[model samples]
Target chain A: MKDVSEMYIPTYDDVLEAHERIAPYIHRTPVLTSSYFNELTGAELFFKCENFQKAGAFKVRGASNAVFGLSEEDAAKGVCTHSSGNHALSLSYAAGRRGIPCNVVMPRTAPEAKKAAVRGYGGIITECEPSTTSREEVFAEVQAKTGGDFVHPYNDPRVIAGQGTCSREFMEQTGGVDMMVAPIGGGGMISGTCLTLSNIAPEVQIIASEPEQADDAYRSFKAGHIIADDAPETIADGLKVPLKERTWHFVSNYVSDILTASEQEIIDAMKLTWQRMKIVMEPSCAVPLATILKNKEKFAGKRVGVIVTGGNVDLDKLPWMLN
Target chain B: MKDVSEMYIPTYDDVLEAHERIAPYIHRTPVLTSSYFNELTGAELFFKCENFQKAGAFKVRGASNAVFGLSEEDAAKGVCTHSSGNHALSLSYAAGRRGIPCNVVMPRTAPEAKKAAVRGYGGIITECEPSTTSREEVFAEVQAKTGGDFVHPYNDPRVIAGQGTCSREFMEQTGGVDMMVAPIGGGGMISGTCLTLSNIAPEVQIIASEPEQADDAYRSFKAGHIIADDAPETIADGLKVPLKERTWHFVSNYVSDILTASEQEIIDAMKLTWQRMKIVMEPSCAVPLATILKNKEKFAGKRVGVIVTGGNVDLDKLPWMLN
Candidate 1:
C-alpha cells in the first residue's frame, strides 16, 4: 500500500468535477422525512437517502466518479477492487455503465445476495479467504495479471470527491442543515461529509456514528490517530473496515465527534426504520439513528441531516429474524 | 348493516369533496418510478406510494374522510370499525388526529405487529374470534354499548370517495397515466380509482388486481355479479375480504379487467419490490406488480399507474421466510 503522504487528497473542485462527470450514471436519490421519528428524536431530521443510489449504496457515488474520471486507455484496461460489500457491486455498476470490466476480490463465503448483485452488475469476481491478508494477496495476483487501474475503496481522492456530492445535494434539497450525521466505516462517507461541509458549511457539526463492535474510526478519532482492528464482529457487516490514511485526514480534522451504537441497538433501529419510515436500509445505515437515540439531548431541536448510506441487505437474513 | 339497494355509491363529486375534507389529514404521497422494473415489464410504471401515507396505508384516506366528514354530534360519539388490518390502524390514526375515541374490533389471531400499530395509533382494541360472524357479533355489542358512529371499512361512501382522491393526485403528479392498476380487496381503492378516472380521464383503463386464492373480484367481474366468500386464505391477508355492493357498482361499471396472481407469485413480487426497489410494502400491494408481470403483453409500452396500497407488513413474518 502507498504511504499516507503519497495519497492524492481531493478538494472541493474535484467534487464539482466528479459531480459533473457522474451526473448521468448515478441517481439523485430522494431526501425523506418522518414526523414520527421527528417526534421521537425531538429533532427535525432530513434523511439523505443514498440507500436508493444506483448500486443500492452511496459507494456508487465514489465508484462512478472513479470510473468516469479514468482516461480512455486506463478505462479500457478496466478497474479493480477488493471488497465483499457495496463498493464491490458499486464499482461493477459504475464500470458497466462505462462499458469497462470491473474485477473484484471478495471472500468465498460472502453472502449469496451480494455476489449476485456484483454478478448482475457484470463484475468479474475472484474469491479469496475471508481475511484481509488473503484479500490483499489475491488482489495483487489478479491486478498484476489484469493490469487494471486500482481504485482504493475509501482512500482514493476521486472516490471521496464523488461521495462528497451527496452532502452537496442534501444541502441543495433541504436549504442547508444545521448539522450532519453519517456512519463511519473506512470513513469514506464521513471524510466526504467533512470535505464538503468543511468548505461550504463549516459551522455544521459533522458527527460520525460507528458500531460499538467495530469502533476503530471512533477509537481513532478519540486517540487523534488511526487505530484499526484485525476483524471486528458486528451485525453492521459493511462497517468492518478500518480507516485508511486519506480518510483519516478528514475524519481527524473536521469530524466533531464519533459515536458508537451497540449491535442490538443497530438492529432495533433498522427494524424501526422499516416499520415506521417504510424504507428498507441496511444495519450499517441505522448507526446514525441509533446514536441519535443514545445522544438525544445533543441533537434536540436541530435540523439534522442523516445520511442513510446504503440498502444492500440480505432480506432472508435480517438480524431480527435470526435465532 | 345498510341494505345493498339503500347504500349510496360514491360519485366523482363526492371524491372531489372528500379530497378537500381530508387534504389536511392525508398525504399527497410521492410518485416513484423504477427504470429496472420498467425494463423488465416493458411498461413505464408510476408507483403512487401510499405506504408512506399517514397510517402506512391508502385506507387512511377513506378513514380520515369518514371521521372528518362526520358532523360534530356524530363525531362526538367517536367512530367504530371491525377490521384486523390497515383500516383498523388508519381509523385509529384518523381518530387520534381529531382526539376522538376509535373502537376497533380485531380478530384474536391478528399479527402482533398489526395489533401494536392499532394501539400505537390510539385505537381501543376489542378482540373477537377470527370469524366474520363473531366479528359482526362483537362489533355490534361494542357499537351498542359505546353508541359510536359505524364506519364500514370499505362500504361507506365517504371512505370510497376518500380513496378516490389518490387517483386524482396521481393524474396531477404524472400529468396523466394511460392505465392504472391497484389491488382489489373490498374494491374500495379500485372503486375510488374508477370513480375518479371515469369522470376526469374517461379514456384511461382501470384494472383490478387480486390474489388467485381470493379472486372473488376477478370471478365476479367476469360473472357480472358480486360474489362473497366466507373465508379465503392467502398470504395477502388484506385482500381476503369480498367486494360490497357499493364498491361493486364502480368495479362492474368502470374496471376494464380484473387480474389475479398465485400466492407464490405474490410473495415473489413482494420480495422483488423489497430487494430491487428497496421499499417495504405488504404482500397485498405486490398483486398489481404480479399482474403487470403476468399480463405484460397487455400493458407493454403503456404508462401504468401502480397504487402501492400499503406498507404494513410484519417484519418477522415475511412470506419468503415462512416454511
Candidate 2:
C-alpha cells in the first residue's frame, strides 16, 4: 500500500501525463451537439459525452490511470474502493484489463444491476450498510484482507489528474467553449475540469452544477470551507457524496461558480435529453443541463460545454417512471 | 408538381448529387462501436447512429433531398406525404427547413406526441381513419387541395438517393464493412444502403432485418417478387409498411438476405442496446441488432455495419416498460 499521510496535489503536468498514460485504456468519447437544446436555451451547447466511455462513465479515465500507474511491486497487490456506482465499475474494469484482482466495498442497498455489472468485470464485492461509518469500516477490513492498494473514488491526486484529461479533449474537440459545466458529486470531474482548464484555457469559466438536495459542494463553495452532508437524498444518486480536501483545493481556487438544480428539474432535463438528444444518460448527468436551463440568461448565446458524466442507471427503475 | 409518368431508378450518380445537396442540412452522424456487443456476437459492429440525425431519423436524408430538389415553382407549392411515424416528422422538418409547407395525412389515432412534433415542425396535418383506404383517400384529396408534390415515403427516386448518402458516409467512415444490416421498413433506408453500397463497395453484402409479424419483405425476397401486406402488426411501428416497386428493385437485386426476429427478441435487443450501448433508439432500429444476435454464425468474425434507423419513440411508453 502507498503512503497517504501527506496531502499531494496533482499539477497540469500530471494531467498531461495521465492523458497519455490512460489513452490506450479509455475512449475519446464523442462530442455531441443538439440543435433542439441549442435553440431552447439560446446557447450553443457542446456535450462532452463520457456517458459512452468504457465502463459507461468518465471515472474509467481516473481508474485506468491509477491502476496503470502502479509500480510492478504495487500492481501485484491490485486495488480496492468503496463505491455503489460508476467508480466501482470503472475500477473493476481497469483492474480486469490489467488482469489484476479488484475488491469493491458496495452498500448492500446498491442496485442488483450495479452489483452484477461490477461482477461482470470480475470485481469481488464486499457489502456494507448504507452509511459512512459502516462503509469505512467494511472497506478497511476488505482492504486489509485483500492486501489491495486503495484507490479513492475522487479525492486521490492520481484520479483527479486522470479526470482532467476529459477537459483537455473537450477543449481540443470543440476548439474552445466560453464555459464548461459539469455535475459536482465528490467534485472529481469538476476539480479535474478546473485543474486542466485553469492551466491551459484559463479564459474558459468552470462551473460546478450540484443537486439541490445534496448541495454540499455548493455550500462549501459559498462557505469557503468543506461542508459535509449526511445521507442527503436525491434522484441523482451519484451527487450525494461530499467534497474532500484535494477536490476542495481545485474547487476553491479555479471554479467560477457552483449552480444547483432541483430533483424535479434534473428528472425533467434527463427525460428531455433522452427524448430529443437520443442519448441514454443518468439523472446525475442531468444536473448541468437542469441548471443551464434554469439560468438561461447567463449562458445564452455562448458556446457552452456540458459534461454528460455517465449512463450507468437502472433501466427498469428510471427516475421519471417512478413519478 | 414534377411529372411521375416513368419510374426513375436512382443510381450512384444520383446518390452523389443527393449527398452534395443535403450535406449542408443533415448531420454526418458518427459511427459508434461496442466492445461488449462485439464480444457477445463475435462480430465487429459499427453502428451508424441516425437516431442523432436531424429530425431524429435517417428519413431526414431522403426528406431533405426531395424537399430541396424541387424547382422554385414546385418548392413553393410544397411537398406532402401520408405517414404516422418518422416520415411525417422528417418531411415536416425538411419543409420547415426549406421554409415551405408540408402536408401530412396521418391516422387520427396516432400518438399525440407525433401530432405535436409534426405541428412543431410546421407540418399541416390532415387526419384520416387508421386504414390504408382512408389514408389514401384523404391523402389524394389533401394533395388535390394543396396542389403539393406527392413525396412517396420510399418509392421516389429522390428519397432513395438521399437515403443512399447515409451508406456513402458509412462506407467512408468504416472504410467498408463486410456486411450492411438495416431494418426493412417501407424499404427507404434499406434501398438506399443497397444503392450506395452496390456501386461503391459491391463486395459488401446487404442484409435486411424485419419483424416476424410484418415479414412482407422477407416473404417478398424469398418469393422473388413484391408481396404487399394489407395490414400487418408489430411493435416496430416504422416497419409495418409493404415495399413498393422502386424499393423492391434494390431489395430483390442487391440484398443478399432478409432476416426476421420475433417480437420478444426485437424488444430484448432494443432494451439491450439502451442498456449497454447507452443510446436511445427506436424499436425499429433494434431490428438489425436483433437479427445479428440471432444469426451470429453468419456474421462471426466479420465487420458489420448496423443502421440505427431512428429515435422517434414515445418515451412515456417504452417497449420494456410495457411489461
Candidate 3:
C-alpha cells in the first residue's frame, strides 16, 4: 500500500496555475444541459462536453500544460510519451502548435484511426508490443535517441493540475453542482476534478465511474491500497491503465466512491448517447452515463454533472460491439 | 407552373422580425468550424450546427416563430402540421412549451424513433400512407376535425421568414463567407438562407444541394420553372418535397445554383461526419457535405459555409445503410 499523504496530489492553487498556463492553448469546451435526460432520470444533468475539446478529448489540457510548462531549453529538445491513443494525439497537437517534435510510443494493436490521428497531428510513432516491459524499453530507447523530455501521461503533478481546469470550467458554467461523476482512467481526470471541486465546492461529491472489467481503481478505492496486478480486459481502452501514486492520493482523499458498470451497460449508454443525444462518444466516455443509468435511484432528483470525456473511437468496431 | 413572382417571398425584414419574435423561445445553435474538412476539400468550412438547435433541428426556429406569430385566438386553438419527422418533433416541442395542443400528421412508414420523439413531446399523431395524396388527405381530415391553425413546414411566408433566422446567425458567426450551401427540400431552409444572405451579404453565392433522386429544385433552377412532379426517392428524407411557390420565388431569385448528390455520396458524407467531426447528422443534413465531396473542384479553396441542418436519424437503420 502506498501512503496517500506522501503522493504528490495537486492543490487548488496548482489547478489555478494550470488554468492560466494552458488557457491560451486549450479550448473552453461547452457545458450542455440535457432536458431529455433530466426528464428521464429525474435529475438535473449538466454535461461538461470534453468531447468537444481539442484533440477530441480532455487529454489536451494536461498534455498542453505539461508540454508548454517545460523550460525553454527542455522544450527545444521536444517531448516523448507512451499512449493508447488520445493522450498521444493531444501531445502531438500541442507540440505541433509550438513547433516542437513529438514522439509517441504506442502499442502495436492501437486502433488505426488513433494512429492516423497522431500522425496527422505531426507526431512520430514508435509501435511496441502491448505490455509494460515493452512500453518502458521502447520509451527509453526513443528518449535516448531523440534526447526529448518524457511527459508521464497522468502521474505528473503538471498533468493532474492541467486536467483540474475541466472542473474549474464546470463549476463556472453551472455555478456549482451537487455532485460529479467522471470516468477513471489512470485517474488523471478524476484526480483533477476532485482537486478543483474540493477547493471551489467542497460540498460537492466526486464519484469515480469505472468499467467492472478493468476494476483496478474500484478495487484500490475499496481496499485503500493501490492494486495494479492482473487488470482485466475491457472495451474502454482509455480506462485500462492502473492508477498512479499521485492520482491515487487525490482519489482516496476527495472521491466519494468508485462505482463500476458492466461492459454491456457502457455499450448501451454509448448507443443511447448516439441515438438520443446525437453525440459521438467512445466506450470510455460512456462510463458516467452508464453509472447513472445503473444506479438511477442515487442520482434521482439531484443536480448532477457528468464529464463526457472523449469521442475518438474506431467506427469499424462500434457496430459489432453494439450488436 | 405557379408564377414565382406571385409567390410570397420573405424579405430580410421578415426574417429579422421572426428572429426577434422567437428569440425567447428558440436557441441560437453554435457554428462549428473544421480544419480537417478544410484540408480535405481545399475549402474553409463553417458548419452551422442546427443539429444542436432546440429539438435537434432548425425546424424549431420556424415552428416557434410560426406558433408565436399567430393571433391570440389561433394560438389558443393550437396548431397542426404533417411531417415525415423533424418538423413534427419541433412543432410538438414548441407547442408543448406554449401550453398548447399540437396535432401532427405523419406517414405510417415514418421511423418509430421519430414517432416516439413526437409523442414524447406531447404531440397527437395521425398516421397515413407514405405519399403526397395520403399526406394531403390526412392533414385535411385532422384540420377539419380539430379546427386547429395550419403551419406549413416550409411553404408558408412566416415559416420561410422564421427559417431565415438561421442564416442571420450563420453570417454573424462566420462573417462574409464566399459561398453558402444548404439542403433543399420544400426549399424552406435554402429559401430562408438565400433571402437572408441576399440582404446581409449579397455577394455570397447561395447554392442549394439536393439528393440526385429528389432533384426537383435542381431541375426547377435549370428550367426556370417549378418541377413538382419529380418522383421522390432519396436517403435525404428532408429533401423529398418539391419547392412550393413562395420558396421557389426566393430560391430562384437569390440562389446561384442547385447541385445534386447521389444517395451513396450522402451516406458516405454522413459516415465521415460521424467519424471525423464527432457529430451525428441525418442523411438529409449531409447533402451539403456530399455535394462538396462529390464536386470538390467547384467548392475547393473557397470559404464555404455548410448548414448541417439536423441530426434526427433512426439508429437502427444506420448499420443497414452502411452495410
**Residue ranges of candidate 3 with Cα displaced over 4 Å:** A1-17, A71-78, A99-101, A126-147, A300-302, A319-321, B1-13, B72-78, B141-146, B174-176, B294-303, B319-321
Model 2 interface RMSD over true interface Cα atoms: 0.7
- Per-residue lDDT of model 1, residues B1-323, tens digit only: 12323677777888989888999988889999988899999999999999999889999999998998778998999999998599999999999999999999998877788999999989999999876778889999999999998988898888888999999999999999899999999988998999899999999999899999999898899899998786788888888888888899999889999899999999999999998889999999999999999999999999999999999988988889897
Which candidate model has the greater TM-score, 1 or 3? Answer: 1
Predicted candidate 1 versus true structure: per-residue lDDT over A207-308, tens digit per residue:
999999999998888888999887678888888889988899999889999999999999999999999989999999999999999999999999999999
Instruction: Return the clash pairs for model 1, or none.
Output: none
**lDDT agreement of model 2 with the native:** 0.91
In candidate 2, what are the lDDT values of residues A1-323, reduced to their tens digit?
23444698888998989999999999999999988999999999999999999999999999999999999898999999998588999999999999999999998877677788999999999999876678889998999899998999998989999999999999999999999999998999998999999899999998999999999999899999999876788888888788999999999999999999999999999999998999999999999999999999999999999999999888888888896
- The residue ranges of model 1 lying beyond 4 angstroms of the native Cα positions read A1-5, B1-5
> Relative to the unseen true structure, what is the C-alpha lDDT of residue A115 in candidate 2, on a scale of 0 to 100?
85
- Which candidate tops lDDT? 2
In model 2, which regions exceed 4 Å deviation? A1-4, B1-3
lDDT (10s digit) by residue, model 3, range A296-321: 89999889999999988877777434
Against the true structure, candidate 3 reaches a TM-score of 0.90
Per-candidate DockQ values are 0.86, 0.84, 0.49
The fnat score for candidate 3 comes to 0.53
